[model samples]
Target: MIVFFFWLSIFIIVYTYAGYPALLYLLGKACRKTKEYEDYEPSITLLIAAYNEEDFIRRKLDNSLNLDYPSEKLQILVVADGSTDKTAEIVQTYESRHVELCFQPQRQGKLAAIDRAMAFARGDIVLFSDANNIYEPGTLKSLVVPFSDPTVGGVSGAKHIIKDENTLGESEGLYWKYESFIKKQETRLGSCSGVSGEIFAIRRALYEPAPRHIINDDFYLAMRLLRRGYRIVYVPQARSFERTSYSKKDEIIRRKRINAGRYQALRYFRQIFPLKYPRLMWQVISHKVFRLLLPFAMIVAFLTNGLALVPGLSKGEPSILRLTFPFNWIIFSIQSLFYLLSVIGNISAGKQGKLVYLPTFLVNSNIASFQGFLQFIKGNETALWEKVKRADNGEQINA
Candidate 1:
C-alpha cells in the first residue's frame, strides 16, 4: 500500500505538470514553423452560431464586417437555433451588408445549427466562431496562413481568456494559458487532440457534418481530420477573446458539460487504439482519456496512502513507517486544504471577489470531471447546450 501510494502521488504530479509540458516541448521542437506567404488569400466563410445572443449579435456582425480580408472573398453566416430573442433579427439587419442569417424556429443543438449553416457556405474555407467571442482585426489572416501547407486540413486559434479582478476569472485565465502552451507543443509534434470551438477553421472540402447529438463538434471535427491523415495546426498569433464563467458554479456547469462530451468522444472513437494510431495515440490518451480518469486516480492515491499507515500493514518496520507517516499526512493535508480552498473560491466567486485560488480551481475541475462520469453512466448526458453565465463586460481572457 505504501509503495502504491508513493508511486501514485508521483504519477499524478508528473502527469499534470511535468509529463504534459515536456511532451509538448519536444513536439514543438520537432515541428517546422509555418512559412510566410504573400498571395495566400483563400475565399473564406465565417460561421457563427447564435442562441439568444441578441445583446452580442450586432457586435459580432460588426466585428466580422471589419475583418481584414477582402470583402468579395469573405462570407459570414449566422445560425440562430431556436432563438426566441432578437438574435436572428439582429443578424438579418446586416443582410447583403456582408452578413447572412439562417434561422430555425424549432430548437436544435449547436451541431444541427452548424450543419444547416454549412450547406449554404460557398467559401473554400469555413471558420467557426461563437457569438460571445470577438476576434482580433487580423485574426482571419493569420488563421488561414497555416492552411497554406497542403498537409494541414484544419487550424485553430489561441483562446485568450479575458482576465478580471474576480478570482474565478483569474484562475480560469491562468489555466487556459497553460492549456494554450500545451496545444502549441502538440501542434508542433503533428496535431492537437482537440481544437477550441470558439475559434477554429477547416477546409470546406474536408468538412464533415457533425451528428446532431454531438456535444463537442470542434473536437470531433478536428479528430475526424486527423483520422483522415490531415494535420490540425495551432495558430498562436490568431486570437479570440471571451469572458470567463461569471462564478464558480457557472464554471462548474460549463466544465461538467465539456467533460461529458469528453466521455462521449472516448466511447465513440475507441477504434483509434494506441498501437494502430501511434502518432496521435499519445495526444488523445494524455490530453483527453487520462484527464477523464484523474479524479479516480486521486481517490485511489488517498485511500492507498491511508491503508498503508494503518497498523499491521508494515509489520517489521514500525519506526520507518511511523517516520514516513508525517510525510503522508502532509500530502493528505495539502489535498484537504485544496478542497477547502475550492469551496472558498466558489463562495468568494458568488460574491464576485478575487482569492488567488489555483488549488481551488484545480480541485473544482476534477470534481466536475467525476460528476460528468456519473452523468454519462446514468445516460443523463445530452448534447443539448447549456449556456453558462459570463462576465458582464464581454472581454477576452488569456487563460
Candidate 2:
C-alpha cells in the first residue's frame, strides 16, 4: 500500500507536467494541418478595465491609439471603476480621440466594471486587455485574422514577459514560453482551453456574461465559448508584452489570486465530464485540474517516500522486500535536493541562474497553489483584487 501510494503520487506529478504535454505533442503532429485564415477586419472594441492605474493608463491608451488597426473601425474603451487616482482623468483626456470612458465612484471589481461598460460597446468583437500590456503594432491585425473562420469563436494572443536580469522575471518569462508551447499544441489538437487575459478577443454576440464573483474572467469567458462547441485559436503572432511583478511577494499574491480563481471556476465547468466531452474533459483535467492538485500529490509522494525507507514500515511486507530500500533512498534524495535548492534560491534572493530559478519557482508556485486552495475554501478571494506592481517603472519602450 505504501509503495502503491508513492508511485501513484509520482505518476500524478510526472503526468501533469510532462506526460500530458508529451501526449499533446504526439497528437498534434498526427493531426496537424495548415490553418487557413484571411484578412479579417471586424469592428473591434478594445476594452481595458483599470483601477487606480495612473502610471500606465497613458501609455496603454497611446499604444492602443497607435495600433495598426483602422481607427475608424476600432473603438478604444477604458473602464475606470473604483479609481481614485488620475486614471480616470487621464482617460477622460482621450475623449477627443473618441476613446470611451466608463467611470464609477465605487469599486465593484473588474467583472462589475466590465458589466457596466458592456452597454456602451458597439463592436462586432471585443478585445480585452490590461493597462500594462504593450502590444506590437501589428497585433490587432493578427488577432482579428482568425475570426475570418466562422469556427474560430475566440482568439487568444501570446504574452512575452520583458526580463531585465530579474530572477522572478526570468522565471515568469520561461513559464510563459512553456505555456505558449502547450497552448500551440492544444490548439493543433482541436482548441485551446487556456487564454491569457492580457490579450484575448471574442465575438460580442457570443459573449455571455460570466458571474460577477468570477475571478479568472478570461478563462471563464473563453471556456464558456468552448462549451458551446466553438473553437478558441491561439495566435502566436498577436503578442502582448509586459514586465514581471516588482518582487517575488507581488508575484505570489497575483498567482494565489489566479489559482484561487481556478478553484472557483471548477464548479462552473462541471458539465465537462469525460463521457460528454472527451477531448475537452481530458484537456481540462490534464492541463488545469491535475496541475491544481499537484502540490497535494507532492506532499503525499514526499511523506510516503520517506516512510518507505524505514524498515518494516509496510506492515505486511516481507524482509525480502528490503531490497527496495536503495531505490527509495535515491528518490528521497532527489526530492530533498529539490527542496534544498528551493531554500537556497530563496535565501540568495536575486540570483539569475536556472538552478536557482527553476527550483524556487516550482516550489514556491506549488506552495502558492496550496495557499490558493485554502483561500478558495475560506472564500477570502474575490473578483475585486489588489493591483500587482510590475518591474517596469514607467518605461515607455515598445517590445
Candidate 3:
C-alpha cells in the first residue's frame, strides 16, 4: 500500500512538471485552430493601476503614450488607488497629455481600482496593464487585431522578462520561456488557460466585475469568458516587458500571493474541468491544478517513502531483484539527496548554476505555495499586498 502511494505521488509530480507539457506539444499538433486576422480597428481603453508608485507613473504613462495606436481611438486611464506618495500628483500632470486619472480616495485593492475604472472605460476593447510593465510599440495594434475574429473574445499578449545579470532574472527569463511555450501550444489547441495581466485585452461587452477580494484578477477575467464558451487566444507578437524580482526571497512573496489566488480559483472553477470540457480541462489540470497541488503531494510522497523503508531497514536483510539493498531505502536516499541539494542551492541563491539553482527554486516555490495554501485556509491573505522591492535601476516599478 505504501509502495503504491509512493510511486503514485512520484508519477503525479513528474507528470505535472515534465510529462504534461510534452504531451501537450504532441496533442497540439493534431488539434489545431485556424485564426483569421484582418485590419481591425476598435477603440481601446488602456487601464493602468498604481499604488504609491510616484516614480513609475511617469514612465508608464510615457510607455502608454508611445503605443502605436490612433490617438483618438486610444484612451489612457490611470487609476491611483489611495497612493500616499506623489503618485497622484504626478498623474494630474498627464491629464493635459490625454491621460485620464481615476483617483479613488481609499486604498481598496487592485481589483477594486479596476472595477472603479471599468465604469468610465469608454472603449470597445479594454486592455489592462501594470504601472511597471512596458508594452512594445506595436503591441496595442497586435492586441486589437485578434478582435477581427468573432470567435476570439479575449486576447492575452506575451510577457517578456528584461534580462540582466541578476540571478533571479536569468532563471525567471527561462521560466517565462517555458510558460510561453505552453501558452503557444495551448493557443494552437484553441484558447489558453489565462492571460498575463501586463498585456491582456477583453471585449468591454463581456467584462464582468471581478470580486474585489479576488487574488488573480487576470485568471478570473479570462476564465469567466471561457465559461461562456468564448475562446481566449494568446498572441506572441503582442509583448510587454517587466524586470524580474531582485531576489528569490522577494519573488517568493509574489509567488505565495499568486498561489493563494490560485487556490481561490479552484474553489470557484470546479465546473469547468475535464468532465465538462475535455481539452480545456486537460490544459487547466496539467497547466494549473497540478501546480497548486504539487507541494502537498510532495509532502505525502516524502512521508510514504520514509515509512515504507522503516520495516525493511529493521529486518536488516531486505533485498530487491537479487540485490541486498531494498528499493524503498534507495528511493528514500535519492529523495534525501535532492533535499540536500535544495539546501545548498538556497545558500547559493543569485548565482547562475542551473543544475543546483533549479532544485532550490523548485523547493522554495513549493514551500511558498504551501504557506500560501495555509494562508488561504486561515483567511489571512487580503486583496492588498505590500509591493516587493525590485532594483532601483531607473526602471519605474508598478506599485
Q: Pick the candidate with the highest TM-score.
A: 2
Arrange candidates by lDDT, highest first: which order?
2, 3, 1
TM-scores of the candidates in the order shown? 0.91, 0.96, 0.92
> Which consecutive 10 residues in model 2 have the weakest lDDT in total?
314-323
In model 2, residue pairs whose N, Cα or C atoms come closer than 3 Å (at least 3 residues apart or on different chains), thus clashing, are none
RMSD of 1: 3.0
In terms of lDDT, which candidate is stronger, 1 or 2?
Answer: 2
Count backbone clashes in candidate 3.
1
lDDT of each residue in 343-364, candidate 2, tens digit only: 8888785565898789899888
Count of clashing pairs, candidate 2: 0
* Candidate 1: residue 95 Cα off by (Å): 1.2
Q: Which ten residues in a row have the lowest lDDT in candidate 3?
A: 314-323
Task: Please give the lDDT score for candidate 2.
Answer: 0.87
lDDT of 1 by residue, 326-375 (tens): 56557667666756766776566343333438877888888899988888
lDDT of 1: 0.79
* Ten contiguous residues with the weakest lDDT in model 1: 314-323
Residue 296 in model 1: shift from native, Å? 1.0
Root-mean-square deviation of every model: 3.0, 2.2, 3.0
